[model samples]
Target: MNFLIEENRNLAPYCSMKAGGNAKYLVQPKSVSELCEAVAYFRSRDEKYIVVGNCSNLLFPDSGYDGAVIITCGIRGISYENGVITAHCGDSLSSLARVACENSRAGLEFCYGIPGTVGGGVYMNAGAYGGELSQYFIRGSFIDKNGEIVVIENNDMDFGYRHSRLNYEELILLSAEFSSVEGDRDAVRARMEELMAKRKASQPLEYPSCGSAFKRPAGHYAGALIEQCGLKGTSVGGAQVSVKHAGFVINTGNATATDVTELLSLVSDTVFNETGVRLEPEIRIIK
Candidate 1:
């Protein structure tokens, strides 16, 4: 087939954290059709496979993955029409937000600075600063385990606080449509820039990190709790709790997955000991 495939590919370069080992096999699909074909190929062989885009919120183990890693970042495409954006799964969330602003479409300005892809954002119901992906979701399509295309509406997505029904199923996202409201272009851009500035000031944007390490606890914020426990700037090898934002664990330099995993456990245990609340990681770790 006319598809790109690599052997023993270093996965660190593919992830934002840049701390993972290699993937035995990596597939880069440039379109929805190619993604489907790649899935079918791996499935027919009864081999393990995963659909990934951006890898911004993932923490891969140092041992590396033994199966096929199908990367859809190459499948990028997007268009805006009639107050709606139809975008491929691989399209960057930032790009989508920019397009919306350019079209004078509001509501997606919150996603303007999120470092993830459309598929990843939809899968996790990504949100920031009082805005969530589910709010604008209309419908989408995915390839089910049976190799059939399944169309899902917003209701069927089952979006909830950084989660979606897609998380529970063995399906690959293809594309999605999001609805937005008409607003002043200047206002949208200004809001986006404001949010970005806030993020830079409060977050450890200079370091490589998996964004927020812990999900927000019901009654307390993760960063606040970490700071309360005096865990800011804590480090396990090259992995360190961000001094700027205690909620994030950043790779100072040459950090291994083991260091990150150990650091996460330490933070979780310490936080739970200091407070009754238990902090759970928001980033997905692959062993």
Candidate 2:
């Protein structure tokens, strides 16, 4: 029992959307052993389960989740030695990037502005400004459904644009090791600052959003397609396609998950109808 289990907990505070129903049960596991214990406990009773990182890319239904919501945010740890950086699943991407910069490492600069955990970034193969996590990733550790720790190499991860093999597996990432080259600390800091400035300038940082709303379609940009369809600033309830960036669907205060879903559907439909190309959501919707 490494986790303190709570009953009927409100989930809104845990998600970036700041709008979600309650969870029948919630567990925050602080370590790998504790995490395994919680998983085993849930499995013994044959209960449904879902693991969450920082909840940056999630939208939980208004009806709430009927099973266990396992939060891994408390399991944080990060270290660097011999040019390899090891980050626990709960370690935030911003923290990791800062650590890299402090060590004068150069590969993780693009991750400086990404608001999520290392586990979440690895799962999504997170990228920005021509740099992706997959480039620096060397290997990772994951706990399988049976509570077995397994190590996987970068090639085995099957990383792609905003996706990885972890999405299909019943495995929980424990930690990851990345390889980075030594660089001038000043240069590294400058690059990170530049990326952060670009994000602040181009994204709707003032509103609540799940970053990019849709995956890039083949032969077309999702935002360009959306803007072409005249869906920018279009609203459904409190949710709206951002006027600043058509690729973002923002919660303009008090937006429900349903509202975001409705807006996403409308945008996808309109874009598909206009461009003959279907857009896929990058945001993960959970119920």
Candidate 3:
């Protein structure tokens, strides 16, 4: 399998937050087979690498990464058979929901505006409005550290509040299947549009962010806690808690990874001090 290896590539553009440095080596796989080949190649060469898809919720340090960054965004495909939908790791979660709606299938409407790919989504068990991927997720294929493909079922995913076995495992997702029941396409689309409207109204979509900045504390909303502490519009360098949504720490044009991390820490501390609820950041802070 032929592939290109880019060196000294800027990593900021790859992340949704648009705040990062550079990578020493980068491999973008164009297909699942290519992804497997790339992983095997790197593993055999004893080269350190980190797999990423979409980079929506990831924060790369400004100092940059010295090893291979294996990006799966180019490996995308989706299909529907009977009541099940199969998607490549690089497939967009939003696109998956839309395809489900198109096939007259309900559920997954909450994924409409999510910016991550299936690999990232499943790794974190992404959800919204009480809808979670684990609900419909059946099983998936992953590439182990040895470069061998392995299958894991829903029962083994260990899904819980934005957590999954992918958190502790060395495997990387390749593809997954989901099941959805039949529904009226019109109603499904309408519901999706309504949710999107709400998102636009409530989120700081005009600024680049990692969606929500913090996980919701048990019986408490992260945003409300930040808002209650009068932390809205707070800024650390170019990173600011969104005035539009206290839950988001947005990059105000020139934000750096340090700025974002500082702002996140400040918000979490302030919220905890005032509300007694320690907020755990949802963003992945990568070195």
Candidate 1 lDDT over residue span 73-133, tens digit each? 9998999999999999999999989999999999999998899999999988999999999
Candidate 1 lDDT (Cα, 0 to 1): 0.92
User: How many backbone clashes are present in model 3?
Assistant: 0
Models 1 onward score TM values of: 0.99, 0.97, 0.98
Worst 10 residues of 3 by lDDT: 143-152
Give candidate 3's whole-model lDDT: 0.92
lDDT of 3 by residue, 170-272 (tens): 9899999999989999999999999899999999899899999999899999998899999999999999999999999999999999999999999988888
lDDT of model number 2: 0.90
Itemize residue pairs with steric clashes in candidate 3.
none
Using TM-score as the measure, what is the rank order of every candidate, best first?
1, 3, 2
lDDT for residue 15 in candidate 3, whole number 0-100: 92
Q: List the residue pairs that clash in candidate 2.
A: none
Model 1 TM-score is 0.99
For each candidate, the alpha-carbon lDDT, in order, equals 0.92, 0.90, 0.92
Give candidate 1 misplaced runs (Cα > 4 Å): none
